[model samples]
Target: MTNHIVERASARLNESTLLEMFWGMLLSRRLDERAWALHRQGKIHFHISGMGHEAAQVGTAFALNRGVDYIHPYYRDLALSLAVGITPTDFMMSLFGRKDEYSSGGRQMPSHFSSKDKHIISGSSPVATQVPQAAGLAFAIQYRQKCGLVDPNDTSQPRLALACLGEGSTSQGEWHEGMNWAGVHKLPFICLVQNNIYAISVPLESQMAVANVADRATAYGVAGVVVDGNDVLAVYDVMVQAVQRAYSGGGATLVEAKTYRPVPHSSDDDDRSYRSREEVAEWKKKDPIMRFQNSLLEDGILNDSLLHDYESRARAEVDKAQADAEAAPLPDAEEVFGSVYAPLEEQP
Candidate 1:
């Protein structure tokens, strides 16, 4: 019932953890930036950005055991994927639809993360569809432990599944159904909602009548909490609490992270039509990466010189990944229908 991670008064914000989290956020930003450029240049077809969700993504990643925990990440999980061992090269391959893309062998869309070796589950494009699937996975984990399939004394016996979705997905029936099931069964599940105040062109006010999505958690008989998605340490602290609760048979928790979407919905969308320049500028001022960098600088954990080097290194990694992806060939013609369907036969 008691755990040190949650009991600690201060967040476990060691210098090393701070550094790792920073690198994840920085690398994700650089990757997203380059991807947007590629889309503009016609090198890539589609692109979705994770500009303002970096802190929350990376913070959540560090809270879970990457290889042990199962993660059902939505499209904008660049930082979470990178933090949990999904390399930038993997993302670049998927983005380019190259043959070497491990996630879906160039089949799935970019930012649809899935790594079997890393325990990252594949997700669908339909919003909130991953919710029920993740609940099922968590139920399996919880069932295995309860039925003695897993040794009770094992350190990683109680593995959990963490699924993330945009706040707009909360409007879907599947999201509520999955949450209800996890709550009733006391399944080891963590539902993360990144509240960016908009769903494509639709604003939050039009999407949901409730002021906060976390308020709905009370209806499920599950623990609910909200955190500043822009603040990496705050998000990390809250996620650790969620992890501890999951480990202790405390069941599901809904973490509604209030963040912003700095860029347009995707490469295809334009913010100029729906949102004002002033609103975008105000949110940009609260950029998660910039805020974290300033915090590190203030704490003496990062100086201007070190920051320059760190940032350059992260960019360099992204550049190499892009180059590698550029050189990699696209999926072969034979592979076009390779995994699409099993019942169909190919025409010669």
Candidate 2:
């Protein structure tokens, strides 16, 4: 089904880049499985699986200029974080809540990814807060350009901010407010909503009256698009266009990627309580990772041996990360308030 899609993508991206995307998706899946195992063993407090959304996350991550554009990702963006350069070791340290964890120094929970070097802003526990923050970042980029702080003539440098959220967050006022502001200001922002059919136990039909989340973008006067989230190449193409528009001074874009959450909302939630087993089974047949791999094999870009090698490497990396993280030290109790506020000496 996706052979033609892969062929089209090959026209725009090389085989190496496609393989990198596959590796990222595979690594994300392995890491998510590891996190779930750690939680079940009582080694971690909570776990949010990003199993089905890896295609969308990784596809969009590769579309952006990784160290340049700011990313305000929701908690489910495990694949996105990894594609943007966050290592498996970083994720393991975060899961183990080690003192040296890059995201928050062990303050934030697992899956709440952040990295200063990668330009991934720290996210809050509250949903949709990153929407406004992303808008602000985009505005700042434009402001700097106007103030001559950034070289306006540098066409190679694209200043944009990407904010990702679940479909449920589209109901939040922050989502609307931030998107509206970005539209009104013509900010370099790309708002991506991963529609996974359900928000916790609540289904999409109950959340909004619109057919698609991107429909809301119409009210904000921004370009709205919907894509097949399971098709990594399709997602990459859409994101490339959106990023180009933003870089060329076009207004914000609202992209709704139709995906599925193969697992429950979190380890604590029971998916069986609300959804049917058959429904999940149906979606499993469309697993993005499997689909992408099949497409690569059909196009002769990948083979069984290469796939096996990549999967083995990914599993080994995850195992090493987990072992290293387990041995790492925890944050000291005395420094509980360390990152919360600045010390008086550094206030000035």
Candidate 3:
């Protein structure tokens, strides 16, 4: 299907909401940038840069209702997590493997964010694990609404669950299982495929024959859209439509955001071995942060001075959060048993 294009100007949206979304993107960018720098300094063990993904992440966050809606985010979704109110300190704590880290209490490796209160489900290192979990949550929402468990008369909407992952994850068995089940049941779920061109060292073209990730939606009989992930306004408009569809019982929609990773897959992998430096440099020119900022400037919604101030504040906040996280205590060996499960009684 042909994509319905939206203007790249933020002025087209509600002014206050547009500003909020812009600020959210800026904050997310700053957090990710600081984390990457910390990794280089050896203060944090590893990091993933969301440099070319701020638009999609911020747009999706603005479209959804935080705490009300469920979000099953992938490892490369630090910007989305932070944009949805996962604090810089919380992220730093996780990066530093401190006891106060909300996701896994420092047990999980860095970049896997999870929070019950924020409705951001815990991330797994395994690919596509959150896909089925998101579908299940959407099913439960429908069940609750049908059973009159929630306000039936309101008709405002039932909550939705978003399962977001990289395009490479689409090749995983769990991805098919989750999409198939949700599509069969006509559940209110949204699957966001961030096609950053490469899945580790492999490109999307090598993984699938389809022209675009959205084309896979044809098998499921749902609306599909492919958008420029670097365009924040375009992404926001598309996500708003998807959110409306799911909430209105229009069923699941699969969105493929065409973007770039702009960095190695992770701290361990070296893309320079398999990918060309020229390709990386070319993608840097269309960097999501620069693109989104340009859009805001074009719309006359933000000046360079304001943008600089926001950047400065973001940097300061990240530094302070890192300091706090670094100073926090690590978990004791005995404390590990407290979180596993309830104690069992001894047999007679």
Candidate 4:
């Protein structure tokens, strides 16, 4: 059933692109597994698993303008960051809180990824904050267009803001406020709700009344869509349309990706308490990485030998990253206040 759908979609993307997607998903899964192991071994203070969300993250990332489009991603977007050029070493440095860690200079928690070079906005601990911030960025992009800073008429250059959040964050007032503003102003914003069934220990039914999170977009008069988040190709297709609409001045879009959280909410939580083993096992049957790999093999894009080689290479890369990060020094206490503010004279 799944193979047929993936096969049809595989034809749309070139073999190299599809292979890249597979590699990202594979690397993310292996990295996530290592993080979990590191947490258990007391090597890391905390860990957030992005085990089941790779397809949606990587797929959406591939659909965007790599160096141009801005992305405001939540913590569990490891695959998304990788697809956007955040290396395994960068993640490891952040995981170990090394002084040279690119994200926050080792100040913030791991997974709060930010890179100016990659067009990724710094994320915060507070949930749903990025929603309004995304709207503001979209507005800024439009402002730049009006000021002739960017050519809006250039169809080739489509600058958009992608705001990603968990479905649980939709309950926050900021989500609604952001959506309302984007809708009214017709901002080039794409709200991606990674609905991973469970918001920590709480299930989707406990938090929202609606069956689909995308339905909330109707209130703001924006295009809302629900896609199989596990299906990488499906996500890519949807994002392509959403990006096109935003670029052409249509309006904002809310994409609800229906996926599952296979691991615990974080390293601190226990999933066995809230969910049954059977349920988790059932979801594993529909594992995104395995599904994609199967399609690739069936389509002759990949083989067993190549799959084995890819896995080995990914693991070795992660191994080197961990070693390098472990050998690096911690952040200096005296420089704690460095990035807090600019000179008073330079302040606005």
Q: What is the per-residue lDDT of model 3 for residues 1-348, given as tens digits with 9 covering 90 to 100?
A: 454645533346776677677787788777887877888888878876676788888888888877668899998887899877788999889888898678888898987888888888988899999999999999998888888788633444438899999999999989988888778878889999988989999987899999788998878777789988987777888888888888888888899999998878887778998789999999999987777678778988788898888888888898899899989999887777776764566434
Error of 2 at 257 (Å): 0.5
- Residue 298, model 4: Cα distance from true site in angstroms: 0.8
User: Which digits, one per residue and each the tens of the lDDT, describe model 4 over residues 72-98?
Assistant: 999999999999999888999999999
What is the lDDT, from 0 to 100, of the residue 5 in candidate 3? 49
Q: How high is each candidate's TM-score?
A: 0.94, 0.95, 0.93, 0.95
Better of 1 and 2 by TM-score: 2
Better of 2 and 3 by lDDT: 2
lDDT of each residue in 72-109, candidate 1, tens digit only: 99999989989989988999999899996989999888
Candidate 4 error regions (>4 Å)? 1-10, 153-158, 344-348
| Per-candidate RMSD, Å | 3.7, 3.0, 3.2, 3.1
Give the local distance difference test score of model 3. Answer: 0.83
lDDT of each: 0.88, 0.89, 0.83, 0.90
Off by over 4 Å in 2: 1-10, 153-158, 343-348
Q: Which stretches of candidate 3 lie over 4 Å from their true place?
A: 1-12, 152-158, 342-348
